[model samples]
Target: MIYLAIGFPPAAKSCAYRMRETANNFVALGWDVTVLTIAEESWEREYGLDHTLSDAVDPRVRIVELPLAREDLATDIREFTEERALNPTRWSKQERERHLEHFPELVFGGWRSALEQGLLDIHREFPADLLLASCAPYVNLAAAWKLWEEHQVPYAIDFRDGWSVDVIGGGEAFTRDSEAGRWEEKVLAEAVAVWCVNDPIADFYRERYPRLAERVHVVRNGFDSDSVPAAHGAPNAEDGLTFGYLGSVNFKPEFLATVLDGWRAARERDPLLARSRFEIRGHIGAGASREANAHMALIRQAESDGVVFGGPVAKAEVAATYGRWDALVLMLVGGRFVTSGKVYEFMASGLPVVSAHEVDHDASAVLTGHPLWTGACGLDAAGLADSFVEAARMAVEATAEQRAEARAHANRFDRGLLMAPAARQLADTVRPALLTGSTQG
Candidate 1:
């Protein structure tokens, strides 16, 4: 199988975990999986690299790195041409227009030719029966379509979020007559299957293309068992509880301000919270603003309020980080369409969660029955302040049995358990003979 996984492993992007597990599952199904991603150095301008992430990938999987990159993310002033250096904003706008001529995606569209040719070269040498493409460099769909058009090789898409749907802003991203809409319609018309991370996204695709309704399936981004702590004890409020927010800080500056305001209010109202600490762990801004952005400034100013910024944790150390936190703060953007991968990991940690997102968010669906969740309080500072206090109460009073039950609620979201059935089903469609003798490890 040729797996078009641009952020496969070693890259610290949140999608790496899902991409790693998907490729590993194919390898386990007796398929010689080869992942195609960009060079390691390319990630330096984006999220940087986390070599620890590559440690979990199956040894049998072969990774092919292409010498492609996002030139827009280039930070070095020396790398900039005279025209770009003079007015970078205008230069970037013109570049984006040029990029759109090659493909619909702005940042990754220029990679189209390289990706298409790369797939052709790989196919001529080894001959893959199936092609599985993961999107967002949704340009991979173009390559997948290219291989299928020329060689008749079947393909599937791990379209975690549907292309036409604006998940963050909540509506259609483009009209059906738009270039991107045309591309999505054409590519998905021939796809063997389409997998979405949640039901809302899958349903959107189903409604958009009723003919492919049966092909669209919900394959939730479940938590990796290894990333969750084996156990967590009740919070020691006297010693001061620790609240953690672990994931990309991609939300808007205003959204973060509301969360910080709530945290400050909670600290003032609750004596335990005043003594406690809130640790923000994850990558902040990328490129020129990496680790230096408005988010960093807000966190820095909150130092007196017991907030510390611990930038980016390695995937291998995730379990240990969860072990140290008394509770979790699920700060996310978007409404019903968004269900972040971290929500599952946070739930699996068995820690009390204080939701700092929309009231009607998809995460609310997942955390519905979780015993330790304080529930969604919208993005209102006063509401979120109450949630923090409630989470503190739950964290301090939760018994061993309660924590165990909280973890139990998330067992259904174990990454392997969620991905294996989909992998086996897709593999069976193209290579049933291989699976007859195949046994999952």
Candidate 2:
């Protein structure tokens, strides 16, 4: 199988975990999986690298690194042309336009030819039976389609979030008649199956393309077992407690401000919170604005309120990081459609959870029956403050049995359990088709 996982291990993106698991699961299913991703330096221009993540990948799964990189993320002045150096903003705008012309994928469309060539070259040497394309650089769909057009190789898409769904902003990202929508429709039309991270996203795709409803599947982004702590140590809030957020800080600045404001209010109202700390560990931004964005500035401003930005944590250290925290702050964006992988990890940690997102969020769906969870009550400062206070109380008073129940709730979502079956199902469906194709041709 040729797995087009652009953000595979070492990229340090949240998507990398799902990608790695997908490829590894395919290998475990007795298929030789070749992961197509960009070079290590390309990741450096984005969230940087974490070699530790590569440790989890199955050794038998082959990886083919493409020479592609996001041109917009280039920081070196020497790499910039005279036109780009003179009018950087205008150059970027023109580049986007140029990229859109090739594949309607915006920043990644220009990479279409290189990706198509990469797949074709790999196929000529070691023929592939199936293709599993993961998106965000939805450009992988173009290559998947290219291989299908030329060689009739069946393909599936691990559309983590459906291409046209505006997961963060809440609505259609583009109309069906639009270039992006057309590309999405064309690719999905030929796809044997489409995997979405949640049911809401799968439903959206099913509803959008009614004929393909049966082909859509909800393959939730489950937690990695190794990333979960063996046991969540008792919360000792005698002196203080620590509330930690371990995910990308990609939310709006105002959203973060509201969280900080709520934190401050909770600290003032609850004596336990006043003595407690909030440690945020994750990537803030990419390229020039990384760690130096408005989010970082706001976090810095809240340093007086015991808020500290510890930056990105390695995959190996995730368990230790969660172990140190008394409770978790699930500050996520989007409603109903967005179920971040962190929510699963946070639940698996067996720590008290304070949700700082919309009441209608999908994470609420996952955390509904969780024992130590303080419900998702919108982003209102007072409500969130109340949640903070409640979470602190839960952290202190929750029994060992309650924490065990919380961890049990997330056991169904262990990465291997969730992915292995999905990988096998795809292999089962495609292997016969490949046999038929080879026989006929």
Candidate 3:
């Protein structure tokens, strides 16, 4: 199997966990998986690479690193052209237009040719029976299509977030007549199976392409069992509780300010929170900004309210991080279309959760049955403050049994459990076609 997974292992992006699990699961199912991703150094300008993440990958699974890198994210002053150094925004805009000539994506379109040639070379050497493409570079679709056009290799897409649906903006990203939309339509039309992270996204694809509706499936990003704490320590009322928010700080600065305002309000009203601490852990910005972005400024400004930014945590230390925290603050963006992987990890931590996102979010749907969740409060300061106070109360008062039940609620969402079945099903579907020497499309 050829796994076109750009953010595979070592890349410290949030999507790496899902990609790693997918490739490992395929290897476990007795398939020789070759993951195609960029070199380790290529990730440095993006999120910076984490070798610890690579340690978890199955040794049997082969990885093929392409020599591709994102030019717009280049941080080295010496590497910059004079025009780019003088007016970065205009240069980036012109570069984006150039990239669109190669493919529809803005940041990753230039990688299309390298990816296509890479797949063709890999296939020439090994003769792959199947190709599984993961997106966000959505350029992987071009490569998968290239292989399918030339060699009859069946391909499936792990569309973590759907293409046409603007998850963040809450609308179609482009019209069907647009180049990007046309590319999405053409590539997805022939996909043997299309996996989406949530039902809303699957519905969008289904509604958009009714003839291919049955091919769409929902494969939620479940929490890794190893990432969840085995046991939760009793809340230390004497020293005050530790509230942690672990995940990418991808939300806007204004959104973060609202969460801080709520935290401050909660601290003022609740005596327990007065001495409590809020820790933010995860990658902040890419390239030159890194941790020196507006988000960092807002978090630093909230220091008086007991908020501290802890930077990024290693994958191996995730469980330990969860164990140390008394409760979780789930600060997310978007509405019903978004269901972040953090939601699963937070629920699995068995900690009381205070949601700082839209009331109509898909994460709200997942947290519906969770016992310790304070519920979504629509990103409003007063409402989120109430949620924080309630979560603090739950953290201090909830019994160990309640925490156990919370973990049990999330057990069904174990990464292996959620992903293995889908992986096996796709493998099974392709096995017969290979045995009979038949083409999928």
Candidate 4:
């Protein structure tokens, strides 16, 4: 099987975890998986690198690194043309327009030819029985389509978030008449299966393409067992409870500010919160603005309220990070559709959770049965402040049994459990076609 996982391990992106698990699970299911991703230097300019993440990948899986990188993230001035150097902003806009011409995808559509050629070369050397394309450089679909067009290789899409849905903006990203919408329609129409991270996204795709609804699957981004603490330590009330958020700070500045405002309000209202500390551990922005963006500025400004930015944590240190925190702050963006992978990890940590997102969010769906979770109440400062106070109280008064129950609620979402069966099912779906020498398309 050829897996087009552009954000595969070492990329340091949240998608990397899901990509890694997908490829590893395929290998475990007795398929020779080859992951196609951009070179390490490409990741360096984006999220830097996290070599620790590569440790979990099955040794049998082959990694094919393409010589592709995001041109916009170039930090070296020497690499830029004189025209680009003279007017970087205009150059970027022109580049985006150019990329859209080849395919509907922005930033990655230009990679269509390279990816198409790459797949053709791999197929010539070792014919592939199946192809699993993961998106976000939705350009991978172009390559998958290329292979299916030329060699009749069956393909599935790990569409973490469907391309048509504007998750952050809460609407259709593009109309069916638009180039992007047309591309998405074409790819998904022929795809053997399409997987989404949450049910809302899957439902969106189903509603959008009723004829292809049965092909859509909800695979979810589950928590890795190794990343969770073996046993959570008792909340240290003497030194004050520690609240932590461990994920990329990619939300809107206003959203983050609202969370900070709520934290401050909670601190003022509750004596326990006033004595407590809030630690944020994750990458803020990419390239020159990393750890130096408006988010960082906000976190810095909230220092007096006991907020501190601890930078990015290594995958190996995730368990230890969770172990140290008394409670977790699930600061997510979007409504209904956005169910972040952090929600699973936070719940699995067996710590009290304060949801700093919308009431209609899908994370609320996952956290509903969780005993220690302070329910979602939109991002209103007062409501979030109440949530914070409630979470602090839970952290102090909740029994270990309650924490155990909270952890148990997330057991169904263990990364391996969620992915292995999905991989096996895909393998089963393709095996008969391969055995009978029949083409899926």
Quantify all predictions' global Cα lDDT against the true fold: 0.91, 0.91, 0.91, 0.90
Q: How close to the true structure is residue 381 of candidate 4, measured as C-alpha lDDT?
A: 94
Please give, for residues 1-441, the per-residue lDDT of candidate 3 as tens digits: 999999887999889999989998999989998888999899998888788898989999989999889898888889889999999989999999988889988888888999999999999888899999999889889999999999989999989998889998787988999988888888888888999999999999899899889999999998988898877757779899999999988889999999999999999999999999999999999988899899998988999899998889999999999988999999899998999999999999999999999999999999998999998879899999999999999998998899999999898989989999999989987888888888764
Off by over 4 Å in 3: none
Worst 10 residues of 1 by lDDT: 432-441
For every model shown, what is its TM-score relative to the native structure?
Answer: 0.97, 0.98, 0.98, 0.98
**For residues 1-441, what per-residue lDDT tens digits would candidate 2 score against the true structure?**
898998898999999999998888888778988888899889999999999999988999888998889889888989899999999999999999999889887798999999999999999988988888998788888898899899888889999988899998777999999988888899899898999999899989999999989889989998998889877656677879999999998889999999999999999999999999999999999998999889999998999999998989999999989988899999999999999999999999999999999999999999989999999889999999999999999998888899899999989989889988888888887767576666111
Which pairs of residues have clashing backbones in candidate 2? none
RMSD of 2: 1.3
- lDDT string, candidate 4, 1-441, tens digits: 888888888989999999899888888778888888889989988888899999998889999989998898888999899989999889999999999988878788899999999999888887899999998888888899899899989999999987889887677888988877777888888988999999889999999999989889899899999889976646767789999999999888999999999999999998999999999999999887888789988988999999999989989889999988999999999888899999999989999999998998889999998999989889899999999999999998988798889999999999989988888888888889888889874
- Score candidate 2 by TM-score against the native: 0.98
lDDT, residue 396, model 4? 85
Predicted structure 2: lDDT? 0.91
Q: What's the TM for model 1? A: 0.97
| Root-mean-square deviation of Cα positions for candidate 1 versus the true structure, in angstroms | 2.9
